[model samples]
Target: MRTRRTRAATAGIGAAALAAAASGAVLPATSAAEPARQQPPPGCETDCEKVFDLSLPYDVRFTGWRDDSAPGGRSVLAYYIGDELHDSRELPDRGVQDAECGWDGDAQRCAVTYYTGAHSTGALSALLTADRGIEETDSVRGGAPGATLRQLDGNGRPDVALRQSTYDPNYADAPRYWETYLEFEGKFVRTGCGAPEQQPSPAPTEPLYGSCAYY
Candidate 1:
């Protein structure tokens, strides 16, 4: 319902991550015969941004940095368990459309968004649970943008709200508005009453992964 612009560093970063991931590229390890590689004199890049808070038991925070040589810089999220770097990865959404992160019940809930043409692309949402039970759920809500997520269950299960223009696309005016909230377990299930009617909207033709009901 409300919007906040994603930080500039995120611009096109998501797409870059996608490209890198798709390419299946890897850097080679240094050879034993060669002398130890010299490390560059680092600045306050990641530290100044506070990638992680060591005092906290857990945190999922977003950080950004500029790289002119890069298509548009970098947008990354770091996941921490205590002070250890549980995991970190590049967010290739191209821009920081919006993001939310915090512990829900006993699990960690994190999400972020970015722009894709005229429509908004809800990139990803992740649930980091105990015993290293991490679930990454993405939208089959493709080809469109504008998505919101909420944790309905006190135990941290998620409910997502996705909206897209269903009206004529030829005009500049925003498309006719239609929205639905899908709950996630193994896949999304209708959280509302009964088998609801699917509105006349331009739903994604591509198959939805997980238990998704985008009709």
Candidate 2:
């Protein structure tokens, strides 16, 4: 819910009239109770906006399937760079999923594998298959939760996967976000951000210097 792959490299909505809401800001009554899983802290808007403005004008798609038909659930996220396989990573805290990455030609592709596993110690490992051949590494951990592994190009651009980690290593839920953006096909798209949502709560009228407006 935080960020669903940068769509169209850009992405807003209205206030009031809760029933007719479609923007990320609006949510059903039942969902309203579900506070955002996380968000950025005060004074992070500048950094957060850097990623948001970079990701503007991109397109995003989402898909999820149940590993089983029972009660709890798990999900997978596949991020595409202009229709090519940009990266595919799974949610860990949700249900202990695994992900792996590799390269093909000048492009990189990722495969997010899912299976039942133990909680272990805030981390888990998985096998990766790609042009680079097979390798295994810790795909998830405790402090950072679903942090992924990433690589960059000669220009210091995100050519491979983009890993998201806590802004502060000491706090798993700190107010900071980071991501990598790359040019796929023709246009450049940002792949991630720290806190991208604008909570539906009322905005401050006095405009205090320390007020928080980020997700």
Candidate 3:
């Protein structure tokens, strides 16, 4: 009777263990903890300036910095939406000349113009939406003075117009104009629709306004 009672107790313990396993109440002896995620380095900590701001039903801000910690000063542009960082771009030069943000149709467009030395300049533009975030970015070899939006293709959505200038050593006094038109089908694409007219004889140093010839 003692042996029978001992066997009954052992069987009851086994049943309890099986029930715990079926109910997912059993745990392993050890578990590996997940690693923490790493974040990108901060864009600016000191010598920061608030360069651009726009209220498109949301708080949008653009801040910049001229970081001198490196060999040469680094130009940094950080974009924020509703106090949260959304995007950033960096350039190694004299710093940004201009930064602007505006609404273009259903998307919000932001642009930055930075000096590239020798009186030459470059621009960076981005297209973003409130829900989808940044959709695309374009780099152009020009200043932001002539950047504009127009309905070039008649697609109901506005297209982007970027202007650039070319100078000839012989005609240093005059600069030739070039315009790039970008249309959005699914993404921003060069339409190659607007080509500048032939440079007039003895081009004027001042900007010559003309129409684009669509090919």
Candidate 4:
């Protein structure tokens, strides 16, 4: 793999828009054999901190964590496929959130959402990839409450949903969400990131990023 510096996008642009103009890198199509669908290694709880050793065709490690100062604001989720180094991003003033990762079989499934934040001058790119890279405009506006690594579609494949501020050209201020499924034959599809039209958060009692029926 031809490597480049790890650069963040300018926090409010689409993947194609920013990647075409910015410095971050994207992996090219691979002819390598597809790894089998395998579950995440045991002992992984939500927002896990340990290195998830993939132990597969490609050596990879998935790490997830939220910064201590503001809790889940400055969240850091990263993948070190072999040997790489990078930095900590700012917390979104209101929107944006931490990164999430897991296993969708032999692939490492991970997600990252973007928004226009007081602290986010980086890029506005959404990335979802594991067996095959699924980054197709994963950006959003309302921040951390919108991105998640969980089952959205009723399937066994790992899915990620991210809400972008603008998805359809027909409307403005439209909160568009998309769910990307990583499945057999790398059969990937798009769906809404998910949420009701009301105020964010199911109730004051639940955690900000907690799993609510409304989402």
Q: Which pairs clash in the backbone of model 3?
A: none
lDDT of 4 by residue, 1-215 (tens): 11123434223323333443244232221222223432222222244332222221234333333333443343333333334322222223322333343333333344444334442212233233332233324333332334444444433333444433333333343444333333223333443234434234321211124222322
Error of 3 at 159 (Å): 6.9
Residue ranges of candidate 4 with Cα displaced over 4 Å: 1-59, 63-78, 81-96, 118-145, 154-158, 161-198, 203-215
Q: Identify the runs in model 1 with alpha carbons over 4 angstroms from their true place.
A: 1-74, 101-106, 129-135, 142-145, 151-157, 167-171, 190-215
TM-score of each: 0.46, 0.21, 0.46, 0.32
lDDT of 2 by residue, 20-53 (tens): 3222232111111212332322222222211110
What tens-digit string does per-residue lDDT give for candidate 1 at 63-87?
A: 3222223454334444433323344
Question: lDDT: which is higher, 1 or 4?
Answer: 1
Q: What is the C-alpha lDDT of each candidate?
A: 0.38, 0.28, 0.44, 0.33
Candidate 2 wrongly placed segments (more than 4 Å): 1-100, 103-135, 139-151, 154-215
Which candidate comes out best when scored by TM-score?
A: 3
lDDT for 18 (candidate 2): 23
TM-score of 1: 0.46
Q: Tell me the lDDT of candidate 2.
A: 0.28
Distance (Å) between predicted and true CA of 151, model 4? 1.3
